[model samples]
Target: MRVKRYIVNALPEAVSMIRTDLGKDAVILETKEIKVGGFMGMFRKKRMEVIAAVESGASKQGGTELPQRKPSPEVNAVVEQILQTAQRSSAAAAVMEPPAQPDPPVSDKRMEREQFIINEIRDLREYMVKLSRQQSDLHALSEPMLALKERLQEQELDSEWIDKLIEALSESEKSADRVYDRVELWGEAKHMLEEWLQPYNNAEISRDARVVHFVGPTGVGKTTTIAKLAAEQTIKRGRNVGFITSDTYRIAAVDQLRTYANILNVPLEVVFSPMDLPKAYKGLSDRDLILMDTAGRNFRSELHVSEVISLLQSNEPNETVLVLSLTGKTADMAIIAERFSKYGIQKVLFTKLDETTVYGAIMNLILKYGLHPTYLASGQNVPDDIERFKAGKYVELLLGDAEHE
Candidate 1:
């Protein structure tokens, strides 16, 4: 794909150009806002970079070209020839000794302006070259720059921010500064996650051995996580463990828990109503740890939240664990955690770490909730993917190994 970069003052106008010049067959790859010129012009004026691609040999499909399309092949050919002439002239000048320099102020200013315009033009020229060499489909470059443009208007619109935003959007495609390193920064992030997740550690699981409730949105691995914890306490620690599931709403949920209980040789109680809470506790009152699995609730739905709240508050679980998926968007996770905060969540369990490539949302959740996580459920492997949440480990994983060195 041929990737052509155009610096226009507007997006629609650039899009129009691509549609008209390159035809409707052109595909937008990336869009960004960059500053041109210096001081006032660079900060105050903004230009959009439209990175588009089109098949070089593609004809107007289904026949005839669009009406009134300007800058035909002849015009493009002439422009190309002129650019080629300019490049040859510039190269020849590079090898020759400089003439007596121009007057001080005029020379400096002219040089700056010339360099700026040349850099911009060079970037576009390189993009055009790439567009000519590659298959159109291989040159996808579209990026979300509207948000960056707004930020540029409000904050620093200098070349630095423009480049940083571009780098972030094209992270998978390009290698910029290894920002994820900075061990000190990773340490701070680790501390923040630990502080938020600190509550999930059930130090009193063997003491009071009271009902520990797990509540969260659907499919957060609460049942499987409970099993992992139970197995750890039973087989590893030799702590007497019992499981009680209030997730009688789904037959599979009960059977799943039952299967785990059967493997552990521990008693399992299914509580469908608030009255069944006492019975569930009585069935496993002698165990060292009572893991109560609650029904999954949709925090967005008032009815579902109310129902789950009623169940949890009826007996007031000694410890409430909020199970959240780290794969969810930061905004959505924050809102859900806040909504469920009313349930008196003492800790959090972040699941689906294997599904997410970035840890930004995890940072958001920890920063927002201030509930330390007890475990990170990475996969569906029972007792295998579940691991104790360690602040240092998380920091290391987030920043990666290269960051520390």
Candidate 2:
């Protein structure tokens, strides 16, 4: 980068100088107002100081090379003296009466030349003052912005989201410390994340909905998540709940959910095929809330995803909850969500939160697929480990600092 500084009186003059010296590609880096040319601080004149930069190899007009230059101490002193004298002369002229006799032609020409120089100096001063104010507005955000970027990267946030966050944070005013206050920065970041996540933050499980199906790829904790929700409905909410498993492909999954059914004292129905779904639903007809657990399959197979969807079709108007693990790769989650989209999956439940510290995948999947996440399963604990998704709490979790009692 080739950086240059200009001290001038007006914004337009500084801009013109930058364009002339550094080319149109020059970027304004910083600017601030400074006082120059004062005697005993009584005649202090305000000017702008601008810091601009251009990338190396940027093309300059006229195919000419200009040597890099810095304002020397003597040059600055001379400029200050000239500005002070011009200001005094201007002030004196404004107050004093004109001479009784007209000046001679030669002297008038000299005076006009001097007046032109003074006008140029005044314009330079105005340019500097404008540049200074612009730079001051940005200066307060510099440190805080750097800190915020580092924090977002440390959290493994997406680059696009990070850029947006930094832009938003930059537009706001900084605190008196002139640095990003950790708590305040996090609060703003959380708010921004929550807004991006708001449309997908929905995890509501309708109480009146008879059947809620949990479906996803293998080993994503589908059966356990169902057990957690079932327990919540039956034990805590005082509502009658039943379990229907189309997951007979794994006897282990069947046995595990059976254990949960026994503990909760709820009925469990096992469907051997899609044809058996109607009978299972009938068996749980009296239940207020019926939670269905579907077999986790290789969702990449069109046939397998179709099979799951067909089984879900046996129970129409049912809520399909796609169970995804936080530990899974984002690419796989997206594919799984797309494959299951045919089943009309409306809600998503994320499991294995305790397995990974990075939670960007959750937000990414929800935003990408436009799906609502209804529950978060942090651990293996059947009921206690699951909670309804709260956008604020989830944002805090992603931002990394939860207050402890």
Candidate 3:
């Protein structure tokens, strides 16, 4: 390869010089306008600096031709910059002088060069943008932004969402041209999170559904969650509530719910399988609200999910709430959410919130699987420990500022 640099009054003169020196196979690799011949830095003449290259083995006599080598990334970047300068120069020239069409070969060659430059520019732009964004995320964050990021990461948030939140904060700070203090940062985080989750802020279970079923994996407190919700209906609302349990696999589960049923004075019915659903429904037919409990099993298996969905089947107006414990791993919780989502169980209830500090799984499940979070159970204290999933309150807990309340 042969490369030469030329300086002239403008790009057109430089192009003519390059063609005479480097032949038809020559390519303009770079172009820039620079100031030259300054007198005490007072005045200078603008000259177009052009860098052109040609294949060393190609025949100038149009006999033998060497293969054109692909440009390196550095070469591509240089060419892209050159193309921008060329476009600006051409635009200025178009306004200053009348246009003249080039010969067929010259026009075709120019088009090929432009098309090549555009393709290289697009690829280079995309790669550079992603690289810059990653670098910015890694290093450009201020102390306050980093603090908030660390806080959310500790709460087990997905990296994808964390970036979105941090980027929004970055934009806000950039616009205002000021760094926020801890209190201000907390306030911004709460506001943004609540806004993002506001669309899914259906905290209460549907009162319209006469029968509500609770399903979950073993030891996730499905029975206890049913008890808590039942207490709400019985004690708070004074509504006629009934309990039906198919948790015969665990005798303790049935007993736990039965104890709550006896205390609430709500009728209790136990069924071993889905076949007994009709008879149990008939027994609780007089009840205005029926809270049904399904046996918890390995949720990872599609077979178990199918079985649980079968038990949840009812012709009456009903809703199924999938209970999950906060102590569970985020990945495991996502898997359960995925499995249950396949069965069309959209509503969810989280249990044992007092046991874990990471509330990210709530946002993860809600946003990712479109799960409607109905309630959160923090303790064993019947209805007092359970509450509807308020977005504002959850954001407060998520941001770790019970003191701000």
Pick the winner on TM-score between candidates 2 and 3.
3
**Residue range 1-405, candidate 3, lDDT tens digits:** 999999876554554466467665567766555789989996898876778887998544321222123333433444455576557645554565554755323345445545544554566455545554565556777777777888889889999899899888878888989988778877888899999999889667887999998888899988878888788887788889999998889758778887888887889999988899999999998999999888889988989998888888789998888899999999999999999998788989999999987899999999999998988899888778988889998988888862332
- The number of the candidate with the highest TM-score is 3
Whole-structure CA lDDT of model 2: 0.74
What lDDT score is found at residue 122 in candidate 3?
64
Q: Name the TM-score of candidate 1.
A: 0.51
Which segments of candidate 3 are over 4 A away from where they belong?
A: 1-133, 402-405
In the predicted model 3, the residue pairs found to clash are: none
The candidate that wins on lDDT is 3
Shift in Å, residue 105, candidate 2? 73
Question: What tens digits encode model 2's per-residue C-alpha lDDT throughout 1-405?
Answer: 999989997655675677678766666655556899989888999997867777899886421222123333422333464455546555555446455566623346446645665666566555555555545544545654666666666656666777677777666544333445666777777788888877766558876577888888889999888888888887788999999988877759899999999998999999989788888888988888888899989998888988888877644456778889988887788788888776667688899988987777777667667788888888888789998898898877777752220
Q: TM-score for all predictions?
A: 0.51, 0.61, 0.67
Give stretches of model 2 more than 4 Å off: 1-143, 173-179, 401-405
Number of backbone collisions per candidate, in order?
18, 17, 0
Return whichever of 1 and 2 wins on TM-score. 2
Candidate 1 wrongly placed segments (more than 4 Å):
1-209, 313-317, 401-405
TM accuracy, model 2? 0.61
Ranking of candidates on lDDT, top first: 3, 2, 1
